[model samples]
Every structure is written in C-alpha cells, then in structure tokens.
Target: MRNARRVILCLGLALAASEPLATLATPAEAFAAQPQVYVVRPGDTLWGIAAHFLKNPWDWPLLWRRNPAIHNPNLIYPGDRIVLRYDAAGVPQLQVIQLRPKMTVSPIPSYHTGVMLPFLGSPGLIAKRSDYERLPYIAAADDSDTIFSNGNRLYVKQLGNLAPGTLLRVVRAGPQLVRPSDRKPLGHALIDLGTAKVLHDGALAEIEITNAREEITLGDRLVPETPVPEPHFFPSSPAHPIQGHIVGSLSNFPEMMVGQVVVVDQGSDAGLVPGNVLQIDGPESVTRDAVTGEHLTLPGRDVGSLMLFRVLPEVSFAVITVAKRGIRVGDALRSPPPEAPKVLGIAP
Candidate 1:
C-alpha cells in the first residue's frame, strides 16, 4: 500500500490545492499556500530555480527528497515541468514532468551542465612545498627548442617507475596565493601547459607532447592528469558555516568575472565540498561617521557567487557563477543568507 501511494505521488497525483500548503513547520515556509509549478527553461540552473521557490535556496534537497527516482537532478532539461505539490502529510515535494518527451531524451541538459569543465583538467592548487618538489620536471628537449608543443620529445626528471603509454599533464607553477588579511601563503596555482605520453621510462623518462594549451618548456612540472568532473551535480550551502576569502584566481586578471575560476582559502577540512555554493562580498572599509565624527567599519557588499568544483585541504577551486560587480582577489566568501528572493518569469 505504501509503495502504491509512492507511485501515485511520483506521478503528481495528490490532494487539491485548497488543502493547506504545508503541515510541517519548517518546510511550510518554503512554499506558498497554493501549489506552484515551473517549466525548466534554457539556461536555467538548479540553484536559480531553488532560489525562485524556497526561502533558503540551499534547502533544495528537501524539495526533491520524496522523488527518489530522480537519480541526478542536474539532468533536468528545458521544457520539463517541475510540479510542486503536497504529500499525504501535507509535506511539500517537487516532481519532474516531462513536458516534451523528445527534449529530455539524451538532450544536452542545459548551459549550466558543464560549467566546471575548463577548470578540471589540471590540478588546481599545489599547496605543499614537498608535493611540488616531488613532481617530475621537464629537464631537456630535442632540437634546442626552448618552447615545446605538439609532437615534441622532452626529457623529465623525478618521474617515478612508470611504463610507456602513461599519460601526464605538463603544468607550470603560477601565482602563490596568500590570505588577503594576514598574507599567509595558501598555495601556488597550477597553470596547465600541455599533455604528454611516456615514450621511454627510465631514470630520466622521455615524453612526447600531444597537446599544448600554453607554451610547454623546460622546468614545467608533470602531474598525473586529473579526470574531468561529471556534468551532473546538485548545489547546496556548505555543511559548516564558512568565513573565507577569495585568495586569488586561476588567471592573472586582478578582477574575476562570471565563468572564471577563483581559489578560496577554506576547503574539505572546513566541511566544504564540490557543489557547495558561496556568496562573494566586497571588502569592508573604515569610514568616518558623518554625524558622530567617529570612525566606523562598514560591511562588505554582496557582489557575486561561486560554486566549488574541486576541494583540497586548505583551498578549493570555484567558478564564478554570478558576478554582479567586479570581484577582486580579497573579496569575502560565505554561505548565502537565509533570505528568500524570487526570480520573476520562471513559471510555466
């Protein structure tokens, strides 16, 4: 009987809209007194949709908790209808209805699907000095070529026992990130140079370059190629309250824009994980009170938001998802507040 009821509920068959919108105290405030439905549109993101419906967008998991069949919520595509209704106990839940069968069948999910792809191919941060020292470095190249590219042969040192055909990525150490407040060193950003395959394995290994995104040259370090992240991931707030800063960005630009990757100072040790979203705030400044003639510190303004795609011990890689203003290196990052703001024109 329970299984039958679950099947019916998954099909979005339940009580009338006249019934009280909620029975549970907490989830009641998440939705309206009447049922609501939204049509997934092109360029729509789970985070954006959740923000449109719930008071605290990070509480999105609660909306889908009853829909166990949704193996990956990120697979939602344009033209799909998301129906919000109450269960028997008057608990609010969200269900996906395939409005256009063809659209959901192996269709590219949305623009937000692979936003993290460009930043995931190389190790984002090399925080420890010993780890940087242990990596194999490009030592010599044939034909006196100082800058190497595709189809070039190079020699590497400190390469451990590895057989031919092993693939590796060539990277150069970029900026050394330091905390904006205390100037404490966090890590060095790894700039991806190119990729190579082991041609000969010995005390000094020979590698043939296959691809080059940047100029691969001597002293470029070799680290095992990192796997690309899966396109599907749900967004949520950090499990622990995070109060960190934007130490630096993956690129040389002083100001970060949307779709650019930035490095944060806090990571897994502080309960941060991939898919956790954080808001960026501009630096607080000391200002003189106009009436009191006293110095007062003003709070930073919320400027943008980013989602962590890769996390390390003391730092993590986050892609700027929303940049309302020019986000600087010293900007602050924390969980989004519990205020509800709706995105207009998102309903079907």
Candidate 2:
C-alpha cells in the first residue's frame, strides 16, 4: 500500500516539475477509478497496459503524454514506471519514466510476442506480381538435397554479388490475394519458410539456413530481411471514415480469433497506417417482412475491433484485438464510433 501523504507529496513534486502542463479535455470517468502506478514487466504490451487503466484500449492516445525527445516515444518496455495523474482541470493522464534507458534494442509496443510477432517481422504479402517473381530462389543444394533444415548449406542462383554476411528471409509464394467486396486482385501471399545467411554472394552463391519455421525445400525464394522497427505510433481512429472487409487470414484459417492476423482490403490508399483501430461487423443478412411482404436487409451487429499493424498499397495486415463472436472472411469493418461522453465526479 502507498502512504497517502507520501503519494500526495510525490504528486505535488511531479506537478511542480511538470511545468506548462498541456490541458486535456478527456473525461475523468474514462480513467480507472483507482489507477495505480504500474511497472511494465516482460511480455506486457501497450494495448494490454492501456486496457488496464482506460475503459476502451483505443482511448490510450487521448490519455497518454509522451516525451518527444525519445526515439520512439510511444514504445514502452519492461521496467518502465507508468504513473497516473490528473491536471488542475481534473482531466486524467498517463505518464511514463524510463527505468532502463540504455538498452540497445527498443522493443515493439504492440503485438510483440506470441503468434503475432512472426507475422509482423516477416513477409506476409507482396502487392505486386513482378516483385514476387524477381526474388532469387534456391537453385541447387549440396548433393542434390531435396529438403534442408538449419545449418545446411545450399546454393542460390540469381542472388547477385553483395556481401558475405547479409541475412535473408526464405519464403514460398502462395495464392493471389483479392478484395472481398469486388473480388479484385490485391497481391500475392508469401509463406515465411525461415531465415538464412549469405556465406557467399553472386550468381550461384553459397548460403546456409540459420532458422527454419518450416522445411526449407528446393526452389524456395529468398528476399532481403525486412527490418522490424519499433513503430512511432499509438492506437487512434482513422483520419477519414474507412469501410473494408476481412479479405483473408495470414494462417489461411477459415475463422479468426483474438491475436490472430487477418488481411483487410483497405490499406495506405484508404489512409490507414500502423496502430489505427477499427470496428468489425458481420455480413448483412437479407430477410422477408411478414406483414408487408417486402424483402428487408438488416445490417450486421457490431462484433469486435481490429488494429492495423502493417499496411501496403491496396491491403493491410491487422490483428483481431477484440472478438465478441467468430470472425471470418467477408466480415465488414468501419471506423469505430465516437466515444460517448460520461458525466461523473472525480474521486481520489
């Protein structure tokens, strides 16, 4: 338990030091009734932490106060101290103090672990046919080996001279992705096979598999490893209203649940970027009106929410953050409704 007077003194000092505090208009009731100081632990995510203190996790951006000097202001890591305080106007806010400031690698704020990390770090889809076909593939292996695993040497043709220590991602091309609404082609999906290093570079270069998610077989394509950086972002509504649908699943599953990645038809062209949260609705159903003998179309019920973590030209990859019911391909999505204002007194 915190000493009441001591906490009061700490707040007094923090408020005194935090000069020219920015005035926020977010309602006090949006915050937790008894918000406490939280220390970020390993495996903790920004979404999970925000959901701990706010009514809606997407409301994080409104309540979070970031330090602009940091490389990635919104990416909080383990050991950081999160403090909750109210301004003179009684508007609640969340602030953080970095405890481990010298760490080399800055971890991602959203979907950093479990099933979503691999998809985020690897190639999930390529939006162009020419781009997919231009990548180099394994032309031959030692002794004509049909399948290779970690630590096995292989030969790749068309891999051009570069360097000896470059890392590459092994992938297999899958079926073409299409928009669920009009069945228009979007791009081709890529299956992440594994990671490999360049022992030699040039046409007919020698390489060795360093990691394998699936068996690295003959003719698997190789593309330069995509660097996954800590996104300078926070969950917020899209700038403009967006209407899209779940076109496909990254895992090729018929149904999707929380923490699973799904491909959406809207992308950069639709003004979407990382950390944009959207609402999900089921497909509309047509029914017959008994009394008037008329056919009626009823809109789908609000099922859940999703956040965009990866965006391309015409499509983007999103993870299901909330699922009220089963989510599937062809389910409708739109900009989340505005948060309803609440009137409540602030209590410490």
- Most accurate candidate by lDDT: 2
Off by over 4 Å in 2: 1-35, 64-73, 85-90, 93-108, 113-124, 128-131, 143-147, 181-183, 287-296, 341-348
For residues 167-233, write the lDDT of model 2, one tens digit per residue.
9889887677777778899877677778899999876899999988878898889988877755546
Model 1 scores a C-alpha lDDT of: 0.69
lDDT of each: 0.69, 0.70
Displacement of residue 89 (Cα, Å) in model 1 is 13
Clashes of 1: 0
TM-score, per-candidate, Cα-based: 0.72, 0.76
Model 2, residue 304: displacement in angstroms?
A: 2.5
Global Cα RMSD, each model: 7.5, 7.6
lDDT of 2: 0.70
Tens digit of lDDT per residue, candidate 1, span 106-131?
Answer: 32322255455545777767877678
Q: Model 2 residue 98 lDDT?
A: 61
